[model samples]
Target: MQYISAERYGNSYRNAEKKRYRDRSRAELVETVAETVFTFCAFCSVLAVASITLYMVVNGTPAVFRVGLKDILFSSTWKPVAKEPSFGIFYVVLSSIAGTAMAVILGVPVALLTAVFLAEVAPKKLAATVGAAVELLAGIPSVIYGMIGMMVLNPVMYRLEQRIFARTPGHQFTGGANLLSAALVLAVMIMPTVISISETAIRAVPAHLRASSYALGASRVQTIFRVVLPAAKPGIATAVVLGVGRALGEAMAVSLVSGGSVNVPLPFRSVRFLTTALVSEMGYAGGLHRQVLFTVGLVLFVFIMLINLSLNRILKERERQDD
Candidate 1:
């Protein structure tokens, strides 16, 4: 082969280098744009949370001071529009806690068992059908749940209420919409979330773990309960935390069935939860009345934040112990 001239060789080398440079530049530009977009999305999420937190704090704190912190928090009176408007929310807070707890109690076991069935026992076709149904349930609007609760569950609750309290002396009737009815509705509302997430978590447990358990002479049920469940504990806990959050935060569905009364959270008693407090009275609320509603929002926000933090900490500790 003939040797190339220096100028020609130089020109060829430069063109190759230019082509590589252009390609690299294009790739870098794409990467930079992608990074920027992702960063912007993340920033927007953070900003949204910060804005809500700030707004709640700003709107909520002044009302507490105006109403007196102890009176607002500890007192049970909630006659917002009465002549001597006492603005206590103790009972509302209690009702929310009781309702959420009751919902969790009724919902979590069914959700966990259903999740286990879907993950470990169900055939593929059956699992798919059930999974689709669960997703559909999740997708159903809160208002629809409320409507169903009002139409179907309320009458059942009313009949049960009459039967249970008819013999009790001086027992007051709660019609149909009451704490128990609301809790039942909340349990149903929260189930899909718990089931979907728990199923996902259980399915994520490695096949090798199941195989190893079987090799050690463990039955399928034993392996699922002892090995797979332990491995999937974190995810299950996360699901439960999310479910609890959903129950606590629900406004529309709870408001529909909860009777919107500021009473003690007895099962047969008509009552309002913290979420319903805001939902029921935000309209026509003026001045300190409106501010008090915002205060309720802040308290709810704090409750959620505390619960999430506590659950997260427990999860971390559990993980560490397991490790």
Candidate 2:
């Protein structure tokens, strides 16, 4: 070979080894830092959730236990204005349940259908547009929804009383701000929640599953119902739980539309929900009245926790079935 310069050869060889070593060192540092960051973030998030829940429980438990379960839940009279007022949370429970039930009945079908259309049938451009619109709906503030219900929806319901009464026929009740109206308002308020969660669940079903179903001569609708929805059932259940939680906790929207009455409702009669009750009267409450509000908050917490626990159980069962 031609004579090579000694210094150049030595410099090139050293540079090559140095470059390789530098790369290896840098990769190791990156991996170590990434692992540390991930663990810290995960642990911090868990701690935050636990801390908040514990704080709520600490503040709420004293009132709940002292009030006794039955008196808190069954006694409908919520007069805190009297001396030595007792806390009763049953009406709140009823209101939460009624509102959540109405939301589920109205929202589930619309959300499921919208999800199906997006995931299965819509053209790409149309699907994108619709999905964006759904997300936007979900992102709109609850306060704005409350304002709209007060200004627009309340008047609308007042006008539609005759139509609603006509549909019921036997009921001669004549009031716009009532249980029915509150339920209707709650239904609208929770629609975006169901739609967003359901859309996510539907989209999570594997494309391969749908393709396999179609290859066996199933139509699109058949494939969707039999293959996609069933596979995503657990996620769908979770979505329902989440929507119910939103409906139950909704204060401003329900308060604005709901008649601010603490009495247990007749089917067409106006009534206050637990959330609305707290919000409506908190401004004027003192002493035991304040404690009663806390009790309402506690009851809502329990309701939401139960829903979440049920959803977790559902998901676990689904997982077991999958395995």
Candidate 3:
């Protein structure tokens, strides 16, 4: 009756214990491997950014010195084909700035309203349909936007130009490709980005916050404006930054609709941006011309970095205030 076999009792107990320890160690190993993989991915991202920055600096610095900084940045004369070549990017810089700014001014308000409607006001079915459309818009290639701008938008703008100058006797009509057309295209291109990101940010605001605001006698609009929007500032700011970045970096669409001419950044005036300047010239550019393109790239890079930094600082300050 008392058959206490060592084989069954002692060995079996030890074996079970060993199995438990092995299982525990395996879990820890899996967790450690996952952590290592994520760390490696993060390191790769940082390395990639660093590499690109270093490459731009290395290739672009020499050009800046070769073409005196003032002429590259300030002088309005950019005649590379003249008997005496001159390469100044004043008009190009202004066009890029004005177009991007105009895009922001035109696009941001509409994007914000659309985002608010989707996140806070729209019925579920309508919101889903609109959200899908916005996503589809974002996925469309820049080239397609350019082609559409060239074929459809330019004609409309040319007609508008003719009408406005019709009574002014023989004004050179821009064939619809002008600063206004470029700005409009950029605004459309930036809208989906701003709307999608902003909607997500607005949706992520905690439900409890809205409920609390309602409990305090706040109406839906007031709660959304006073509480939800403030909470979503970081994401909205991120959306704005990315939108501006895209507007600033967009060459294909802007070049197609902007008439590719160096001129003042008037709404209906034919103009060229920094991005367009590089894209249009780089195909055949050589020597100083080629090197200066690199400098232009550097300038664009610095502009993007500065915008990102300034937005991040502003976000941080806002966060501190909230805290």
* lDDT (CA) per prediction: 0.91, 0.77, 0.91
Q: How accurate locally is residue 28 in candidate 2, as Cα lDDT from 0 to 100?
A: 97
RMSD, every candidate, angstroms: 3.3, 5.6, 4.3
Tell me the tens digit of each residue's lDDT in model 3 across 66-112: 87999889989988767777889889999999999999999998999
TM-score of 2: 0.79
Q: How far off is residue 233 in model 3, in Å?
A: 3.1
Estimated TM-score for each candidate: 0.88, 0.79, 0.84
Please give the lDDT score at residue 8 for candidate 1: 66
Taking the candidates one at a time, how many backbone clashes does each contain?
Answer: 0, 0, 0
Question: Where does the lowest 10-residue lDDT sum fall in candidate 2?
Answer: 1-10
Model 3 ranges with Cα > 4 A deviation = 1-41, 208-219, 318-322
RMSD of 2: 5.6
For model 2, how many clashes? 0
Candidate 2, lDDT over the whole model: 0.77
Candidate 2's error at 66, in angstroms?
4.7
Residue pairs whose backbone atoms clash in candidate 1: none
